[model samples]
Target: MLKLVMMNDALRNGDAHLKNFGLVYDDVMRPRLSPVYDVLTTQVWFPQEVPALAMQKTDPRGTEKWLDQLELERLASLSHCHNVDIVQMQAQCREIALQSMATTLDECPKCPPRKALEHALKIIEGALPVPSSSAKT
Candidate 1:
């Protein structure tokens, strides 16, 4: 879930709030995570704006900081979170980020330049708690 929120921000420059995410329940009375929605290119409007719900560990909740290894491990230790394999998550997040950008381009013909998308990729890659070339300098 942390990865998804960060991906929405890092990959698409979105501003996901609590309202934008939720759980879905099936007819059989089981609950499952819902697909991420309400995503938008918020950076296009508020270029310097931060996400409504910032990812955090030991850090302050509202501050959007680039997560490092120990921080990610803390999250992965949670009962219902991604695995602790940071490397694997990093690669997977990159793949998802690229796919998301391509999908955006396909759906929104007026999408911004490729370089801008690439820049977002770095953010997404960096959110995996590892050193990535795309991380903000």
Candidate 2:
């Protein structure tokens, strides 16, 4: 769920790739989702693409709104791909994700992207509980 949100932001910001992500494992040998990897691309890559979208914009606010709408669309597709409820799971995940990204960017200055993702994973871990140790055993 969190990964979908981060990926939505990444797609919105135009940073899509595996290098942007990492994974961790739990006691039950399951993989855990990481925070946001490769976010710097937004700062590094977004400006070049902006002028194209900007020209289509009749109103200044349209550009920002367009990005938000794009994010939501991507979230829906992603949710479907994962076989989850788009509105209930993805929407809620995106809301939590926005907050997670804001908090990571603010408090974790100089934190490595992997580290940031680890933090984000921790946050979502509670919301989407992992399989229990007993279940795994």
Candidate 3:
């Protein structure tokens, strides 16, 4: 669930805030994050600005909405209420989001030259864990 939300946020450049994500209970009352929806490419509009939600308890940096590696780690920790293997989480979420992002952009008329969309995907893909070396202090 955390991975999916972070992935959607990556694909949408940090627009996938708490309100943009939710869960649905099963007949047995088990909860699961709802399918990714309302993932708008706000990047084209707001560029890299404030995230829709804060990643840390009182993270002022998150207000910048850059979706950098530090924020990814913070989100990962929060996703399951503890730290999980960010590498595995990213791989899983990327697989789920890539198809949708590609399909959506592939259909866009403005996404000409093909490479343009590809370039965009690469940027979103870079929204991965901020390695310890580069992560903010």
Candidate 4:
């Protein structure tokens, strides 16, 4: 899941952070990937207190310099490559998050976190299908 997010162009831009991830555990106490949360786009907002740099008029390259100085390789890669599919995945993740927010409760007394996770699992289970070839004939 970390790898997926690392490769994701939308997340690469600036959204990847500790707040965006979570974890879940099964009945037998096995930990697994949890529903994504707090997914959003981020932009480099230049500080109002800082003065903008002056560069040569013919070679105005402040943006490139800023990006390099800030180590924004992830953003650079996404901007330079074919990231349409990653964008689609990010959209799907956002939809899932919206659906969860609209329908899920913040707290459930009966089953607590486990039951809530089960509910989320049901929502995404269709995406993971059993292999037909492995089924008993």
Candidate 5:
């Protein structure tokens, strides 16, 4: 759940809401988070899109609202993770997003132009909360 929230913020996917998440059953009938799906860069189209059903509220009259360090901290606390964990997760999500989006932009034929997607990726990257390299667990 933590990773999903972080990834949604990192990828600037404004369509991630409770309904988008589901539980998948294991062989023992234990349920776990289903693989993330329906992810769309709604901000690329709407530009003013805020996170869907995020914990924090966005100002109606304001521009796009993004999760920041404080929100990350709050999420971490709720998930029982340390600050260092959030930092590492954020870095991992950013790296994964960059690589995956690169492949997507290169291979997707029906998708928008590479340049436009690249611009959108830049916006997503810009919104990530920068973690300190020197921070330790």
Candidate 6:
């Protein structure tokens, strides 16, 4: 779940509200998160758009639309995740988003959508942090 939040943030998915998530029951009747869908980089189209829901613990008023590194750590704490997990998830999400966007950009034709995707890719790559060389080792 935290990973989903990280992924959406990295990809600038502004429409990722509670309604976007679904639950499925397995054969043993245990509930599990359904595969994610309806992902969009609404931020590119609506630059002023904010996250559909606030994940910050400090934002009692839910006014914190955009999340920063500190807020991400707070969110992980609220979600009962170890701090290390959030750090790892951030790096993983960054890599996945960059790879996905690069592949899409290559296959995309030379057009406006491609332009928007290129812009989105730049935003995504810039927003998320890469793990340090020391950390990678």
Best by lDDT: 6
By TM-score, highest first, what's the ranking? 6, 5, 1, 3, 2, 4
How would you encode candidate 2's per-residue C-alpha lDDT over 61-124 as one tens digit per residue? 6663323443544555645755544344444554555567667777877777856455444443
Q: Which candidate has the top score in TM-score?
A: 6
Candidate 1 scores a C-alpha RMSD against the true structure in Å of: 5.5
For all the candidates, what are their Cα RMSDs to the real structure?
5.5, 12.5, 6.0, 14.9, 4.4, 2.6
Candidate 2 yields a Cα-based lDDT of 0.46
Candidate 2: regions farther than 4 A off: 1-11, 26-28, 40-83, 93-137
Q: What lDDT would candidate 1 get against the real structure?
A: 0.61
Cα lDDT tens digits, model 6, 15-101, are 999998888888557888899998878888987777886565456676847677778887777778874656667888888888888
Error of 4 at 136 (Å): 38
For candidate 2, the TM-score is 0.33
| lDDT of candidates 1 onward, in order | 0.61, 0.46, 0.61, 0.38, 0.76, 0.80
Clashing pairs in 5: none
| Residue 39's lDDT in candidate 1 | 70
Candidate 5 residues lying further than 4 Å off, grouped into runs, are 27-29, 56-64, 82-84, 108-115, 129-137
Consecutive 10-residue window with the lowest summed lDDT within model 3: 127-136
lDDT of 1 by residue, 1-115 (tens): 7667445544545467788778997855877779878775566555565656655657655466445566666767764575556555655666776678677657766665755
What is the Cα-based TM-score of model 6? 0.82
Per-model TM values vs. the true structure: 0.61, 0.33, 0.58, 0.28, 0.76, 0.82
**Over the stretch 36-117, how does candidate 4's per-residue lDDT look in tens digits?**
6654322222111111222122234434221221132344354574344433444455345435533554444355555444
- The Cα error of candidate 4 at residue 51, in Å, is 23
